[model samples]
Target: MLSEVYPFQETAEAARRVQLNDHLGELGVLCLAPSPGLGVTDATLRSRIGEDRITSLMAA
Candidate 1:
């Protein structure tokens, strides 16, 4: 896995960079590389899969 000094913070920053592109079009700051290491959390999966042990989602 790739790592960076900053991860999600920079990933979100990269999104903002896209926003910046609109103004920097002539300045040519395209293709800003978002740092690797954007990660998934257990909470992230829990949102989709349902975390309750009593009535959790089941697969057929």
Candidate 2:
């Protein structure tokens, strides 16, 4: 699953995964790109990094 935190990096990774999947197809392998979504629990919210900081980073 792809993390929603770093969208740009995740997007690049997903693209690479797609390319890899094409190669894997020859070996009967499969690669799936799925989003886990921006799920921040209460525990995460109480961590050192707040939701606002995470949101700002994501926007960056």
Which candidate should be chosen as best, given TM-score against the real structure?
2
Put down candidate 1 lDDT per residue, 1-60, tens digits, no spaces. Answer: 111133444456655655776333222112332422223346766577665542311111
lDDT (C-alpha, whole model) for all candidates: 0.37, 0.38
Largest lDDT belongs to which candidate?
2
Clashes of each: 0, 0
lDDT of 2: 0.38
RMSD of each: 13.5, 11.2
Off by over 4 Å in 2: 1-35, 56-60
Model 1, global lDDT = 0.37
